[model samples]
Target: MAESADASGGGENKSVHVCVAFNVSNSKMPAFCEAACKLLAHAKADKGCRRFDFQREVNWLRSVSNEEHSLFMVRQGWDTADAVEAHVKSPHAQRFDGTLVSESMLVCAPSLSLFGSAMTTSDLAAIAAEARATQGSEAAEPAGTSSRPVSAARSNGSRPSS
Candidate 1:
C-alpha cells in the first residue's frame, strides 16, 4: 500500500489525507501506469498538494488464482480538506476520471478514503487509540505471519521470503 502523511502546525491549519487503490488487468497495466504517472505529476505540481506517492503491489503468489489483476495505490496529502476538494474539481482530475470510465482500460472500480482531523478532542483520542491497538496487534504477529501485508520489493531490490 502507498502511505503518505502530512502535518501542519498552527490552530487554523489542518491536513487532509487521501488514499485510493485500483486494480488493472494484466493487459492494461502498462497504459494504466503511464496515465497514472501523468496524473500524479500534475497533482504534485498543484500548489495545494503537500505530498503524493504511487505504488504497485507485487503478488508473490501469482501462480495462484487469488488475483487476476495488479493493484496500484495512490496516496496523497493536502494542506486542507478544501484543497482536496479543489483537486477533485481540477481539469486533470476530470480527465483521469474519464480514463477510469473507459471500457478498454480494464480497470476495476477503485476503493477510496479521505481522512481529516476530528473536531472534538475525544474523537481524536479514540482514533489515536485505535491506531495504536492495530499497530500492537501487527507487532505481536510471528515473523512471516504478520497481519499487515508487506510489499514484495525492498529498497535493495530483494524480496522478503513468504
Candidate 2:
C-alpha cells in the first residue's frame, strides 16, 4: 500500500507511505528473508527514503488461519512521489526481480496498492467534533448543513486558528 498527496492540482506536495507483502513457503522463508534484507539495505541507503523496515509474522496460528504461507511485510515512507518512482526504477530494485524468481525461493509476486489524498488540516477539527458528537447516534448529518462548526471557517475562506 502507498499513500501520497494528490498530483492533480497546483501547490500540492507529494509524499508516499508504502507497504508490500510477500508470501513464501516455510521452506523458502530463509532465502526470501535474505533477499529482502539485501533489498532493505539498498532502499535505506536511498536519500529520499524516510523509513524502510521489514517484519515477519510470528504467530503460527494466525498465519495458518489467514494464509498457509509465511508472510513478510515491507513498510516504507518516501519524501516524495518522485523518490518512490526513482526507487522502483533503480538497479537495486531491478535485481530483486531475479532473486524473487530464483529456483530456491517460493516468494509470490508482491501485493501493492497506492492511494493519494490532499494534504490539508481543513475541517479536521469539525469532522472530529462531529464524530464525537455522533458516536452512538444512528442519524446522519443533513446534506446542506453540518453539525454546528463544520462550515463556519470554510464559509469565511479562512481556517480556524489552531
Candidate number with greatest TM-score = 1
> Each prediction's Cα RMSD?
10.8, 12.3
Candidate 1 lowest-lDDT run of ten: 1-10
Candidate 1 versus the native: TM-score? 0.60
Clashing pairs in 2: none
- For candidate 1, write residues 25-133 as lDDT tens digits: 7777677877888898899988779988987776575421134566677888887777887888889988887886774664445767766543467666766888899
How far residue 134's Cα lies from its native spot in candidate 1, in Å, is 21
Go through the candidates in order and give each one's C-alpha lDDT.
0.68, 0.63
Q: What is the lDDT of candidate 1?
A: 0.68
Residue 137, candidate 2: Cα error in Å is 25
